[model samples]
Target chain A: MSELAQALDTLARRRLGGDAATGLARMTAGATQEIWRFMLVKDGAETPLILRRAPGGDRVSESATGLEIEASLMEAAEAAGVPVPHVKWVLTPDDGIGHGFVMAFVEGETLGGRIARGEAFAEARKVLTRQCGEALAAIHRIDPAAFPTLKRVTPLEFVTQYRDGYLASNWPRPVFDLAFRWLLDRCPPPPENPRLVHGDFRNGNIMVGPDGLRAVLDWELAHVADPMEDMGWICANSWRFGVEDKPVGGFGLREELWAGYEAAGGEKVDPERALFWEVFGSLRWGVMCCGMANSFRTADPSVERAVIARRTSETEIDLLRLLAA
Target chain B: MQDQPTPSEILGAVARFLKEVVVAETKGATSFNVRVAANALEMMRRQLDTAPAAEAAELASLKALLGIENEDEGGDLATLNAELARRLGAGELDLKTPGVADHLWATTLAKLSVDQPTYWGYRAALAERAAPTET
Candidate 1:
């Protein structure tokens, strides 16, 4: 048996006593980690559970957020009325499984392209923008003081981080240079009330059901930052997935999203802040593309990463559109 | 001179084969790989068709904007661009600088023409440029 399977079985026994884990199998090789789906047979009942963990070993190294913190954040968000999968157990060194947490498996469409273009989601798309805005507001309402360990970043600091990353990538495109300068010049003042920012809140990170929004996944990049950062990221052109007309995650308009957010008790959405963050998001994505290519050169030589590098030009054009006026 | 089938044509042929044949036969991750491979092939084809002239024009603009003469020995596109990026980062060149915005716009538009002509932003910019003047 694989080390993960043995660990899950042992952990399952400890948690469920008589009802042991019957089967554990690999699910998907996600971008950052490995996902495993297992079944626990307790009292003639079969319950499905999902385990998300860092792939290599017991020590979590590569991820920005540790599994323990992610579990805690999920619990906090769930308590704050955000839809997130119920975390079942957090793996410890004693559990023999690598650092991870098991949660109830959520069944929905997570693919952004499919959610954007698929006809089956047409009904759900009608209300998803508002739902997404409401959910983001709830997420922002989570007190940063509650999570003492979450990184607190100012707007200027965030831009500086992107600037440093772009410089470190060593792939100097003039367009990126122009964007860095422009973002630096247009940096907004730090917010007085910084809230929890869902750092990667966008179409793909969300799970959509036929009815409407189900849950927000991928809390790896969550931090304490400007609430408007989340608002802008969801509306960034990159997340539109070819539905260029629909500004908010290819689902609806900014007005609808903003209205929902305000209704949900978030501070009035700032259009200028959102726009700045959109531009920032695009430039950050460009730097990320370059960084991915740099990593491909130094580490994993995957074809996907190589292809992603070519997409830097896409962001260049996007930057021009955003900055031209 | 090269053979009748030029490099660009060769790439186009391979891209078509991958998109039409291999992609249809594959599933899951392999299918995704085939698609990305085909896209990269097409991008290479477009670059081969457009890069030389684009790079030349870009180099000329960089030379003019930065006021570099042949005596300095830094007219190549890569070196000139690296220098330009360094200057921009250091605030040596700003939007107020003569020809800086025009150079950036022309160069970026040229790149988009080759890299993603159908991109929404590129198309919108093109339309905005060709729109009828205000009365």
Candidate 2:
């Protein structure tokens, strides 16, 4: 058995009280983390669970909220009526595995392309914009004061980090430089009422079923900032999956998203601020594309990241549309 | 002076093989990756065919905009771009500066031409170019 399987077996026997766990396979090809779905059998009953963990040891970066913290965040969100998979077990040292948590496997299509374009999701697409808004409202309603572990960042701080990241990549795309300077020059003042922002909230992070939005996933970049950040991120062109006309995850209009957010009692939907962040979001994705390519040369050498590097130009054009004529 | 097939032709041949032969043999995620790999080869082919002229134009624009002659003489595109980035980051040049916006627009358009000609934003820009000029 693989080390992961053995550890999972141990974890299952101890925590889940399962007789066996079979069909351990990777859920997706992730650049930063490993996700595995398996069936735990106890008394001839089967339970589906997902294991999420960093591939290496716990060298948590400043931006990451850490797996343990993420597990706790999921619990908090679940309790607060946000749709998240129920976390069952958080790894301990005795589990003899790297940092990770296990949760009840939520069944849905998480692929952005399918969620945006597939015919099967026609109904889901109809409800996604409003559901996305409602979910964000629930997420933002989670009081940051309750969870001190969640990083609190101001707009300036995040912009500086992005600028530093671009510099670190050393790719020297001047268009990114222009966008970065533009963001710095126009950085919005700190929101009067800061709330929990799903820092990476967008198409792929959302899981959808034929019914509607099933679960909001991937809290790795969750932080406390302007709640509008979440709204702007969803409207970013990168998440549209080529359905450029539909701003809300390529499934619905911005007005529909705004209406949904307003209906959910989210802070009055700020169109101007959202537009600003939309521009910032495009530049951010451009920087991230370069970062992925840099990772291809640096720590993680994956063809996926290498291909994504070429996508920086897509963002460049996105920036032009947002910033210039 | 390599032989007759040329770099872009070689890239086109490999892309065709990946799309036609390898893609047919593969299934599931590998199939998706084969298509992505083929697309990357197409991008490379475009880059190889277009980069020299684009780089030369970008270099000339950078020299004029930054008011520096021979600043990039001993340097490559990456180095010259890094210098420009440093200046832009330091606020020495901005949209208000002469030629800055035009240079960025032209350079980014050049990049889209090579990396993603069919991207919606690029297509929109092309449409705008084709539109009749207002009085």
Candidate 3:
């Protein structure tokens, strides 16, 4: 058995009520992290679990968000009525599982393409989009002061930090530099009141079921900042999955999302500010795609990732045109 | 037009061959190595397909936009890339001007295939945004 499997078996015996069965199925998305679905069967009842581990190749930074923090945040969000899977266990460096955490395996449709295509969840898509907005509002409503363990960064500064980080990497993209200048020249001030922000909240990161949203998954990039950050992120064009016409992850309209947010007692969002952040979000993703391209150039060369990265330039151009307008 | 394989073309061919053959063999190895190799191959393929076209197009566009008649002397990719950045940094290209929108549209179409519906959707959106408001 592999080291991860053995460690999981140990963890299963310790935490779960039954024997753990491991099967590796490839999740279509997630460029920065590897996701594996782990199945646990105890007392003839099978429980599905998700294992998220760090990238195996070259280390970009030792300070990458640890899995323990992710698990803790998920648990907090779940407790706060945010739809998220239950955290079962967190594996530490000493656990020999290589920086990962185990959570109850969420059963739902995750692939954004499928969701955008409305193949499996046509009716669920409209409901889930509103639910996504509601869930995002719930996440943003979480008091940052309560979660002192989570990192705090101003929402407006996210754009600068991302731009500077990508620029410092010295990737061969002048468009990114242009986008950075545009972002800096038009940087909106951070929200008056900060709250927990899921840095990577979008349709793809969310899981949906027949009932509605199963869970908002992937908290690796979670942070505390303007709630609008999540709003802008979900509305970013890249997440629309070719259905740019349907702004809310190609499922529903933005007004419907705002309606859900307002119903959830969330603060009214400024359209102009949301537009700025939406542009910023697209630009940030463009730089990230450049980083992925750089990764392909230097360390790992996954065609899937590279192709995805190359397509980011289109997004960059799109944002530039938006800002130029 | 028939021509000899350029350096970028040669690299692309090699990358395509590797993706077709070598990548499949490395699938069962350490995921890290597999990902690295796969990405490298794709990057190489992209460089082969895009690098030359990108270099030539950027130079031509810059020169035409700036009305420069002199031939570009930069031979190496780094030098050309840096020169393009320098030119762009000088504020020679303004994407906000009237005709520049058309240029931006053309450039976008060139980079992202014109055939992509998303590209045209974006163009239409931009056009709608730029249109004069009704009283």
**Could you give the interface RMSD of each candidate, to one decimal?**
1.8, 1.6, 5.4
In candidate 3, the residue pairs with backbone N, CA or C atoms under 3 Å apart (3 or more residues apart, or in different chains) clash, namely: A48-A105, A49-A105, A300-B36, A301-B36, A301-B38, A301-B39, A301-B40, A302-B38, A302-B39
Lowest-scoring 10 consecutive residues by lDDT in candidate 1 chain A?
A: A55-64
Q: After TM-score superposition, what is the CA distance of residue A271 in candidate 1 from its true location, in Å?
A: 1.7
lDDT of 2: 0.85
Q: For residues A113-213, could you state the per-residue lDDT of candidate 3 as single tens digits? A: 78888667877876877788788888877778876766677755787688666766674455555565566666777667888888898878888876678
Q: Rank the candidates by TM-score, best first.
A: 1, 2, 3
lDDT of 1 by residue, A71-176 (tens): 9899889988899999988877777777889898888999998888789899999999999889998898887898888888999999999989888877668878
TM-score of each: 0.92, 0.90, 0.78
In model 2, how well does chain A match by TM-score?
0.94
Stronger candidate by TM-score (1 vs 3)? 1
lDDT of 2 by residue, A1-325 (tens): 8878887887888997798887799886665677899999899888899999886645565567889989988998898778999999999888887788999998899889899999999999998999898888888888888878787888888888888888887778777877887888878999888898878889999889999888999999988899988898898988888887889888989888888888887889868888878888888888888888767888767666787787898898788767766
| Error in Å for residue A93 of model 2 | 1.7
Off by over 4 Å in 3: A1-3, A19-34, A55-63, A92-98, A169-178, B1-58, B64-93, B114-135
In candidate 2, residue B43 scores what lDDT? 88
Candidates 1 onward: DockQ, in order? 0.60, 0.64, 0.21
